[model samples]
Target: MTAFQQQLLDVNGITLSIYSAGPDSGRPVWLLHGFPECWYSWRSQMTALAEAGYRVYAPEMRGYGDSSAPEDVAAYQILTLCADIQGAMDALGHTDVCMIGHDWGAPVAWHLGLLEPERVSVLGAMSVPFGGRPKRPAIDIMREANVGRFNYIVYFQEPGVAEAELNADIERSMRLLIGGNSDVFLHPKPADAQFLAGLDVPTTYPEWCNEQDFAVYLRTLNKHGFHGPLNWYRNFEVNWQSTEFLAGRQVLQPTLFLLGEDDPVGKLEAYTVKKMGELVPRLESHVLSECGHWIQNERAGRVNELLLEFLGRHYPRAGIV
Candidate 1:
């Protein structure tokens, strides 16, 4: 396995700790991690993609890892977050790149491609769809749709709720989110007693999670806390208003969407494929059977295969435009 090299890049007033792989002269791939995750989330992908002859860079989004996190809540706005991606690209002298993001990172990737199409060559998203936020804030839409269980998004908007609740029980919450417990919640009814017993039980879940990997994420957030990351949820209405300008803009770039069959986002009646296809016409979708929200970690081999095929087809090394 090729070892990863870490570097510090100062872009847009934030210093990002970048994990990079592959030869310096190769085309670039930018991997963006979602909430509660760090650049470490893309560790497996960086090595694999680099082996396939592409340069890969994964940045711990602001507030998440060794990256700088500003105290102002507005600093976390989606637009500002999107700028960070551009700044990262410019810092590396990349005029265009293949962009891949998971969860919250997906939306930022979408916006980056939409607003600055020339800078992105292809896009891949995991665990999230591309319909954009609803006309109303997600809270209002969820309330109207009667998805009472979606209260978590609203809870995140509340100042200090996520930080308090999630931070109050950091280890368990980390285990739950990163352990793929979101899969347990996706079931139609209460999971079997065995399922409940499966969680927080024997602690074997940490097998896939290394101590140093988890520490990088836990320490960063535990130091800055989750408030900054949670601010992404608080910007629902602001994001809606800002993104309205791109209402008709679809991500025409070669795109791939991967979701765990058991992902809550997939199970939601609102995230239907028809809706997804309408918003992103060129999207190729796949649902990993039995996989969960953390598709990359839960089903790394399959996820890597799909990514390889998609990237090969769209960003082939044989030809250059």
Candidate 2:
């Protein structure tokens, strides 16, 4: 595996800690991680892609690890998140890139495809799919759908409430939250339920994440706490309202979407795949059987294979010229 070179750069008024590998001359591949996770989440894929001669860059997305965590809730809005990556790419001097993201990062990647089609040569997203900008604020939609139930998004709407519970015990929170399946969010809970109320803390880590990997996540959350991350969820309505200009815009880039069969998020968002197809014309998608939310980590080998195959076809290293 190629050793990662870490650097910090001021982008979009915030400093981002970027972990990069592979040759500087190789085609740029930006890996954006989701909430509660740092750049370390893409360690396996980073190694594989770097070894395959594709320069890989994974950043500790705002609020995680060494990246800047702004105090204001509005600072974490979706467009601002995309702007952070855009600025990072500008700082790196890369105009064209193969951009990929997972979970919350998926939305950023998808939006960037719309916001910068010519610059993002190819796009990939896992776990989450873009179904186009909603007609109304997403918070309103979630609230109506989750009425009389405990929806995590709705639960995260209150500023300090979820932060208090999640930050109470960083290690325990990381353990239970990462180890648990997506059903925790998919299934209905009482309206008064807390985020980590009844989840069990695993004595041993999952196969994809060992004690060492677990330690990295623990140290990260303990550093910045969950305020910045939870702030992401708090901006659902804000994101929707601000992105109204993208109402009918489609992400015209050659795209790939991956999902895990067992991921309850897939169940909750089954309709999105179809909508994504309508919104992303050149999209190629897949569902890895028996996998879950942590698609890249849980199925690193297959994910890398699919990514390499997809890139070789549409955004190959040799095609950069």
Candidate 3:
């Protein structure tokens, strides 16, 4: 693996801390992390891709880690978030590049492709797949789907409650998320139950995530507060409005969808995947067993294998230094 360096770039009034590796002359790739996670999430991929001759940049994203954290909720709107990615691209002066994202970052990557298709080469998403916007209101869709255990999304819409709960017990929160602390976050259930139950426990990770790593997340989120990250959920209406025209927009670029079979987030109804496939006509889906929501960590080897193969298929390495 090649050595990666950390640098800060001031793009569009926001200063972003970016971790980058690989050859300076190689094709550039940007990896975006989701909520409750920072640029560290892509540490493995950054190393591997960099070694494979791609210039990879993984940013902490605004409101996470050493990046700017604006207090206003509107600051985290989808449009602005999309601009952050574009701004980063512009700052690097890269006209087009390979883009990969997970969870919240996946949606932003989707928006980036839609808003500026010419700027993106190929797309790779983990855990979350594109299903366009909800046809009916999200509430109506949830109620109709009989999604009982996943009530946290609706609860998060209330504001203050989740932040309060998460802040009250950072260790406990980390425990629930990583399956390290008492195997529970708030309630008493098996370490795996929280994830399998389909609740939006951002902290509920697997055992590989320990105290040292959890503290990194807690420190950043606690300092920034959950409002900015939660704002991603609050922008459903805005996303819906902006993406209405994308009802049947096809993502023509080569795409990859990686998920874990045990991932509650990935265990949505069949229609969701169907809708995603319909929208992204070129999507190739893969599901790994014995894995959960944190697919990248739980199944790094397999994820790396898939990513390497996909990139090779689309952008073969020819005669390049």
Clashes of each: 0, 0, 5
User: Relative to the true structure, how large is the alpha-carbon lDDT of every model?
Assistant: 0.76, 0.89, 0.73
Clashes of 1: 0
lDDT of 1 by residue, 133-171 (tens): 565766677556534343456446667656776776566
Q: Is candidate 1 or candidate 3 better by lDDT?
A: 1
Instruction: lDDT for model 3, please.
Output: 0.73
All-Cα superposition RMSD per candidate: 3.9, 1.1, 4.5
Against the true structure, whose lDDT is highest? 2
**Candidate of highest TM-score:** 2
**Candidate with the larger TM-score of 2 and 3:** 2
Candidate 1 vs 2: which has more TM-score: 2
Show the lowest summed lDDT stretch of 10 residues, model 2: 180-189
Residue pairs whose backbone atoms clash in candidate 3: 176-204, 177-203, 177-204, 177-205, 178-205
* Candidate 2 vs 3: which has more lDDT: 2
